[model samples]
Target: MSERVLMKGNEALAEAAISAGCKCFFGYPITPQTEISAYLSKRLPKVGGVFLQAESEIAAINMVYGCAGTGTRCMTSSSSPGISLKSEGLSYIAGADLPCVVINVQRGGPGLGGIQPSQADYWQATRALGHGDFHVIVLAPSTVQEMADLVTRAFDLADEYRMPVMLLADGLLGQMMEPVVFKKREENGKSFDKSWAANGHGGKRKHNIINSLYLEATELEEKIHERFKRYDEIKAKHTMAESYMTDDADVIIAAYGSTARLARTAAEKARSLGIKAGVFRPITLYPFPVNELREATKTAKRVLVCEMSMGQMVDDVRLALECKIPVDFFGRTGGIIPKPEEILEKLKGV
Candidate 1:
C-alpha cells in the first residue's frame, strides 16, 4: 500500500498523471490551477517526463495533439477561457481520434469572470467542448483522492476508446488540501492494447493514419455515423454515478463534483429533521447515469439540482426524470459555493 500524503487537489492531480505514465504535459497557467503546472515543472523532469509551458492555450493544446499523434501519453490543463482557446485543437484531436487527457480546474466564467471556485463550466465541459459531433468522456472528481484515482481511469478510458478524456474539477477541488493515498501503477494500469500506438512499426506493418478530414460528403457522413455508434456503446457501458440513501428518499439532491460534497452533508441534516433526503453524485457528466437517477428518484417527491452555475446540469436531471417529480434548482454563481445550511434550508422547503 502507498503511504498517505497530504496535498492540494491540483498537485495531487499532477502526481496522479505521473503515476499514469503521462510522459508529456503542455499547458498555460490559469487561476486556481496554476499550481498544477508549477508542480509539474519541478516534478516532470525528475521522472524523465516532458513539461512545456506553451505560449498560449492554443499552442498548448496543439502540442498535446503532436505528442498524442506519436502514441505518447500526454495531457493539458486550463481554466474556462483557456479551454475556449484550446477548443480548436480539442476538436481536431477528437476528429482525428487521438487519445489524451485534459483537466479543467474551472473558475467562474462567461469571460474571465473571477478567480474563485465555480462550476460554471459544466455546460462548456459536458455540452459544447468543441464544435463538432463528438464526445469527450467527462469525469467529475469531488475528492483529492478521486483527483488522483480518476486520472488513471481517464487515461485508461481515453486509450480504450481512442478519444480524449476530461477531468472536470472546480477551483475548490483544485486548491483545497486533503489527505489521500494513491494506488500502485500495477493496480491502476492501462487495459488498452497499445498495438495501435503510432510508434514506428518499421517495415513490418501497414502505415496507420490518424485523420478526421473526409472530402467526400458521403464519406464524412459515414464516419460521423460510425462515431455515433461508438458513442452509444460508451453511453451504455460507462455511465456512472453514486447514490446515497436514495432507497426511500423523499428529496433527492442531484449534484456533482465539489457541490455534491455539500449536498451530502445537507442530506444528512435533512435526514435529522425527519426528511428522507439523499444525494446523487454524477461521476461521469457526459455519459450521465440517467437510468440510475430515474430509478433512485422513483419514490422522490422532489429533486433539487444544485450547481455553482446558473442551472446548467438541472436541465439534464429534469430531462432524465422527465418531470415525473418536481425538479427544483438552487445555485450560487460567480465563484460562490452554497453553504450546507443554505442547501439544507432549500432541501427542507422543496
Candidate 2:
C-alpha cells in the first residue's frame, strides 16, 4: 500500500534516497538545497545510515566516493557553485566507474550568482560537468513527486550501470511542496552485488583494484570505448519524456526541469487564446529524448525552447530537429524565472 503526503521537494529527495536503500549521504549546506542536508542529518541516523555535513562541497563528494568504493549506495548534493567545486571528484568517480548519485538543485551562475531558481547549469550538468570524456546519466524532475521518484530511479540506474547519475533539479522544484506517493520498501531481502567492491576481500579473493588508471594506452582506449557503448545502450533504453497536446500543434515548446511546469501552464494559456501550442518535457536530460523531438518537429512549424538559461538547451533542440524546423529560444538569466505570461507573449509573436 502507498500513502500520499505533502512534502517539500528537498525533503522528498532525502526520503526517497533512504527508501531506495541508500545508506550513506555526504553533503554541504547551500542555498535552495540546505533543506536536503538538514533533512538527511535528522533522518539518516534513525535508519541506521550515515549522514555527514562535510566542511565543503569538495569534501562531501570525496566522502561519497569513499563510501561508494565499499559498494554502498551513497549520494551527495549541491547547487551550481558548489557542484563546480566537486568537479574533480566527479571526474574521478566517473573514471573509476563507481556507482553513486549526485543531485544538483541548480541556481544561476557563471560565478557565485543568486540563489533563486535557474536552469543555467544545463550545459554543465549535461556536458562539461568534469574534465573527461565521460557522461553522467542526468534526470530532470519537473515536480516534487518526480523529484522523489527520480532520485530512487537515479540510484537504480547508477548501480545498474556502475556509473554516476545526476538528479538535475532547480530551486523551484526543490522548494515547492506537493503530494507524493512513495513505493513500499523492498522486503524481498535483496541487496547490492558487491563482488567488485573493495570491502576487504577475505581468503576467497587475492587482490582488488578500484583505480581508474590503466598504464597501457590500448587498455585505456578499450575501457573508454566500452564505457561509451554502455552509454549508448542506456540512451536506447532510458530516454524518458512527456508530450502534451503535441499531436496536432503548430508550435511546440521544449523545456525541462522546473521550466517545463511553467511551459505547461503557458501552453494551456495559449490554447485558451485559440493558439495551437504543445509542450515536450524531457525527463532525461543527457539522452534528451531527441528522437521524440525529431518526430514532433515533423509536423510542427516552430519549436520554442523555453529555459531558465540563455539558450543552452536550444542547441540540443536544433540538433534534434536537424534544421528541419525553426527553433526559437526564450530565457531569463541571473536567477530570474520566466513567467507564464511572458511565455504566452512569446508564443503570440510566433
Candidate 3:
C-alpha cells in the first residue's frame, strides 16, 4: 500500500495529473485554483512535462486544443469566469474530437462574485459548458482523496471517448488539506492508438487532418449524429454514484461535489435522531447517474436535493425520480456552505 501523505487538494490534483501521463498543462492563474498552476509550474518540469501560464484563459484552452491534436496528454485549469472565457475553445476541442482534461475549481459566480466556495457552476459543467450538441464527461469529487483519484479517471475517459473531460471541484475542496494515498502509477506508455492524430505522418502514410469545420450542412449534421451515438454509449456505461445507508430510508438527500460531504454528515445526524434518512451522491454530474439515483431513492418517501447553488441539480433529481416521490430543495447560494445541522433540519421536515 502507498503511504498516505498530507496535502492540499489542489496540489494533490496536480501530482495526480502528472501520474496520469499528462505531459502538457496550459492555464491561467485564478483564485482558489492558483495553487494548482503554482504546483504544476515547479513539478511538471521536474517530470519532463511542459507547463505554460498563458496570458489569458482563452489562450490557455486553445493551447490545450493544439496539444491535444498532436495526441499529447494535456490539460488546463481555471475558476468559474475563466472557464466561461474558455468556452469557445472548449467547443472547438469537442468539435474536433480531441482528448484533453479540464479543471474548474469554482468560486462564487455570475460576474466576479466573491472568492468563496461555490457550486454554482454545476449547470455550466453538466449542461452548456460549450455551445452546440456536445457534452463533456463531468466528474464531481467530494473528498480531497477523490480530488486526486479523479484526475487519472478524467484523463483515461477523455482518451477513451476522444473528447474533453472536466473535473468539477469547488473552492473548499481546492483549499482543504487532507491525508490522501495516491495509487501506484500504472505505466501504460503510449497506450492509446492515435492514428487519427495530426502529428506528422511518415512518408508511408497519408497526412491526418484534425478539424472541426464541415462546410456542407449535410456533412455537419451527419458528424453531430455520430457524436451523439458516442454520447449514448457513454451515458449507458459511465454513470457513477454513491449510496449511503439508503436501503430502507424514508428520506433521501441528493447532492454532489463538496456539498455531498455535508449531506452525508446530515444523514448520519438524521439517523441518530431516529429519522430514516440516507444520502445519494452522484459522482458523475454529466451522465447524472439516473439509474443509480432511482435505485437509491426506491424506498424514499421524500427526496431533498441540496446544493451551494440556487436549486440547479434539484431539477435533475426530480426528473430522474419521475416525480413519483415528492422532491424538495434546500440551498445556500453565493458561497454560503450549508451546515450539516441545517441539512438535518431539512431532512427532518421532509
Candidate 4:
C-alpha cells in the first residue's frame, strides 16, 4: 500500500523531487513558491542532496544549467517574475537538450502584479517562455496530490527526453493542503538513458559536450529539424487530458490547473438544473490533448472556457475545435479566483 500523508502542495512538490532522485536544487526565493525552496533547503541536506540559495533568479537557473551538464538530477522553483528572469537559462537548457525540472508556482503578473493566485503566465509558458523556436513539456496539476504526482512525472519526462519540463501551477494549489498517497518510484514507466550524460567518467569514456551554439547556419538548421522530429513524436504519443460527464452534453467547460476545480463544480451545478454540461481538463499544456478534446466536445452545442487569466487558454481551445463550435471565455485576473457560483452563472448565459 502507498503511504498517505497530508501536505501543502509546495511542500509535497519538494518531497516529490527528493523521491524522484533529484539531488541538487538551485533557486532563489519568490512569493507563493518560497515554501518549495524553504522545505527543500532543510530536507535536501538531510538526504545528502545540495540546496543552494542563489543571489538572483538568473544566477540560480544558470547554476542549474551547469549542474545538469554534469548529469546530476537537478531542479529549480520560482514564481512569475523569477521565471521571467530565468528564461534565458531555460532557452539555453532547451537548446542544449539538458534534462531538468523547473517549477512555477504562479502568482498574478504582467509585471509584479500581485502575490495572489493567477494563471496570467499561460502565454509565457505555452507560447514564448524563451526567445527561440523551442517547447517544454508543460504539466498542469490541479490538486495537492496532483502537485506531488506531476513533479515525479516532470523529472521522468525531462530525463527521458533530455529537455526541461515545467510544472505550471498557481498559488492556490501551492498553498492548499490535502492527503496524497505518495506512490513508489517504481510506478514511473518512462525509461531513462544516461549514456550521453556528462558524468566525469574521464578516460574510460568519450567526453559529453553540452553546447547550444552552432556557428554554422546549416548545422543549426539540421539540429532544429531533428528536434522538431522528436517533438512530433511526442505530440502524437504523450497527449493527456481528463473528461468528466462530457457524454451527451449540450455545453462543455474547458479548463486546466486550479480553475478546473471550479469548472467541475459548475458543471455539476448545471447538471442539477437539467442542463447538459461537462468539463475537459488538459493535463499537458504543451503537446496538448487535441484529439481527446475534439472527440469529447464534438457533439456539444457550445464550449465555455474559464480561467484565472483573461482568456489565455481559451485561444488553444478555440484552435483545437477549429472554431467549429461556438467558444466563449469568462475569466478574472490580477489574483482574483472566480467562485463556482460565478462560473455557473456564466454557464447559464452561455
Global lDDT of each candidate: 0.91, 0.90, 0.93, 0.92
Better of 2 and 3 by TM-score: 3
- Residue pairs with backbone atoms closer than 3 Å in model 2 (clashes): none
Per-residue lDDT of candidate 3, residues 183-237 (tens digit)? 9876663377789898898887999888999999999999999999988999999
* Residue 272's lDDT in candidate 2: 95
lDDT of 4 at 63: 97
Superior by lDDT: candidate 2 or candidate 3? 3
Over 1-350, each residue of candidate 1 has an lDDT whose tens digit, in order, gives 48998999999999999999899999999998999999999999999999999999999999999889888899999998899999999999999888999999989888988999998888888889999988899999999999998988899888888899999999999999999898778854746666766778799998777777989999988888887898899999998899999999999999999999999999998999899999999999988889989888989999999999899999899888887899999999999999999999988788
Per TM-score, the best of the predicted structures is: 3
lDDT, candidate 4, equals: 0.92
- What is the Cα-based lDDT of residue 188 in candidate 3? 61
For candidate 3, which ten residues in a row score worst on lDDT? Answer: 184-193
In the order shown, the candidates' Cα RMSDs to the true structure are 1.3, 1.3, 1.1, 1.3
Ranking by TM-score: 3, 4, 2, 1
User: Model 3, clash count?
Assistant: 0
Using alpha carbons, what is the TM-score of model 2? 0.97
